[model samples]
Target: MTRARTSLLPYLLLAPSLLFLAALFLVPLLQTIGLSLTENGELSPANYQRMVGDLNFVPSLRNTFVLVLVVVPAQVVFALAMATMLQKLRLGRDIVLWIWTIPLGVSDLAAGLVWLAILQDRGYLNSALMALGVIDGPTPWLTYETPVALFFSVVAAEVWRATAIVLVILVAGLQLIPREYAEAAEVFGARPWTIFRRITLPLLRPSLQTALILRTVLAFEVFAVVYAIGGRNFPVLVGEAFVWQTDNQNTGVAAAYAMLVVVISLASTVFYLRALRTPPEQQP
Candidate 1:
């Protein structure tokens, strides 16, 4: 009875947080899913069928997949490189880390605006190219109806804004790794590349896996950058969902879109976890 009471105490103490999550997250999510599967106060499969045939819905899914696929890897690699370099440098590390994290403080909307200014016609990029005689005239950046250009602009904005987050996670993970392992590898005449490939990367996998899953999940829901740069014509998943809810006043469809976002995020997270499963020896 005493042991049972002890266990119950912890759960009782945790009851508020669990209830809060259920109220705010789980309940709303279940409600959204219910909404997507119903129409006109009736349980109908029309929502799912419509999403399959809808032009915008399919494209939004594709755009989200592309955005996450490109941005997650790009952001992780850039963050890893930055973290590795930062870890190696002995002097001014504090200052550089502070500078790197400055971007995290900048709002996504603000970052998009900053990049829009630089990439616009007659903007700094064009001005510099012209001054260097690299181009004859101002080049159209946001004007051309190219998906690649649209994606690149979105990626550039997101990377600038979110790279610091990944850097911080990686740096913290690196700190957790004992110095003795690296020293041991060095004493055994292990080259830098070998040490990194075998020791550093293996030890950092848990953190990297976490960062990748988080960034990928966030990337799928990206809105501000595409909205600011590509506008409505080149909409991603979240932006399209917003349009469906606000512009079209289609709550059912919007809920369907929201459910799609949740599905995509959950799928990506599962894939990452499966792919990054630790070896038995490394398992906690």
Candidate 2:
């Protein structure tokens, strides 16, 4: 009886968490999937078909992919550098980290507004450029005609706002790495880059995988930043989803878009897992 009770304890302990996940995530996900497959109470692919046939669909999908490709890599590199610097800092490290991570506390909409203020015509960037004699007039940085500028502005805002998330994860990973490995490598005269390449990076694979997966998923769902900065000019997948639900009042098409975003996110997570797979011997 004691053994049986002990065996049941684990499942009992897991019940609340499992139930919460089912209620909050699994239920909504299943409902969304069902909605994506139905139209007006009948099972149909009309929602998906309409979504695919929409004029904004391809552009939004392409823009989403491009944004993820551009921003994720840049954030990863920048975050890694920042994490490395933080790890090396011996004095005022906490203060520096606190300062660097301030953006993490700012909401995405707020971050977008902040960047919009800087990138808009007559904004700080233009004022600075004009003061520096770099431009004779406002450059129309966020204009519809300047798609490249709009694209880059969204990318810059995303990178600045989210890199700290990756940085925090990497910094935690760096902290877990034993200093002895680096010190031993140094004793054998391994260069800093070589030590990082052969030692630090390989051990940091799990963290990198987690960070990449999370960031890539969020990149797919990015809406507020793009909406705030580019508006209708910069069509993206999540923005299209919002438009279908709000502007068109089509819940079916909105669900389809949501499913597509989920599919892309799952695919990216799978790619990261395969690409960053740690060897059996490397498993902790």
Candidate 3:
């Protein structure tokens, strides 16, 4: 009786959470999948076919991939540098981290708007450039004709807004790392770079895995910021989905696009899980 009750206890405790997950995530996911796989009251791949055939589909897919490729690596590098600085800081670490994490409280739309104010032709960036005699007039960066500029503008906003999440994860991960390992490495005359490359990074793998999975998923789902900053100038996967749903009144196609996003995100998560697989013996 005791053993039976003990085994039941864990599942009993998990029941509510499992129910919640099913209600919130699994249910919606099944619905989306069904929607994506059906059209006109019949089971068909029509929606996906329409989605892929859409004029904006290829551009949106390419831009989303480009944005993810640029933004994810940049954010990881920036967050790692910021986390390293925090770990070494002897003064105002909390204040600096608090300042660095200010972006965390900002919503996607709001962050995009914030950068919009800075990067718009007549916005702060152009104004500052003009003030410094770098430009004679306001510069149009977020425009279709300036594809390179438009791309970088979106990338910058994304990096600024999302890097803080990675930083927080890494900071927590770094905190968990015992300082003695680094100290012992130092005693053995290990260079700081060598210590980080071997000790800190190996210990931080779990956190890196988590950060990559999360950021990669979000990168695929990038929308509002691109919409806000580049508008229709820069097409992204989620943006095209929005256009299909609201602008074109095609819920089926939108659902198809969404399913594609989910599929890509799942693949990326699986890749990270396998690539960053930490053996039980290496678990920190």
Candidate 4:
């Protein structure tokens, strides 16, 4: 009876968390899936077909992919560098990290608005350029004629806003690494890059995998930042979902878009799991 209670205790302790997940996530997800499959109070795939055939669908899909491809790698590299710097800092380390992570407190929409103010015509960037005699007038930095520039602006905002998340994760991972391994490598005259490449990176793989999976999934769901900066000028998957639900009043198609985002997010997660597979020897 004692052994039975011991075995049951673990499940009892976990029961609350399991129930919370079911109520908060699992139930809503099931509802969304159900909504995606129904149209006009009947079962149908028309919602999905409508989502696929929408005029903005291809462009939104492409832009989302482009942003993810451009932003995720840049954030990874930047976050890793910042994490390494934080690890090496001996003084004012907390201050620097606090400053760096300020953006983590800022919402996606707020970050976008902040950047929009800078990139808009007659905004700070143009004001600075004009003061420098770089241009006679404010340039149309976020204009429809300059779609590439607008795309880049969204990418830049996303990187600045989201890199902090990745940085925090990598910093925690770096802290877990024993300093002895790095010091031992240095004793053998391993170059800075060599130590990082061989010792630090190999051990940081698990953290890297976690960070990548999270950031990539968020990238696919990016909406507010793009909307704030580019509006309908830069359509994206989430934006389309918003339009279908709010503007078009089509809950079925909106659910389809949501499901599509989930599918892409799942697919990317699977890809990262495979690509960043830790060997049995490296498993923690």
TM-scores, each model vs. reference: 0.93, 0.97, 0.97, 0.97
List model 3 lDDT by residue over 32-120, tens digit each. Answer: 99889988889999998898888889999999998999999999999999999999899999999999999999999999998999999
Local accuracy by lDDT, each model = 0.85, 0.95, 0.94, 0.95
lDDT tens string, model 1, 1-284?
99999989989999999999999999999999999999999999887777666678767778778777787788888999999999889999999999989998887778888888888787898899999999999887885466677678878888888988889999999999899999999999999899999999998888888888888888888888778777775767788778878988888888888888899899989998988877788666
TM-score, model 1 to reference: 0.93
Poorly placed runs, candidate 3 (over 4 Å): none
Output the TM-score of candidate 2.
0.97
Q: What is the lDDT of residue 225 in candidate 1?
A: 77
Least lDDT summed over 10 consecutive residues: which range in candidate 4?
A: 275-284
Error of 3 at 61 (Å): 0.6
Per-residue lDDT of 125-183 in model 2, one digit per residue for the tens?
A: 99999999999998998878999989999999999999999999999999999999999
Ranking by lDDT: 2, 4, 3, 1
The runs of at least 3 residues in candidate 4 whose Cα sits more than 4 Å from the true structure, single-residue gaps closed, are none
TM-score of 4: 0.97
- Candidate 3 global TM-score: 0.97
Off by over 4 Å in 1: none
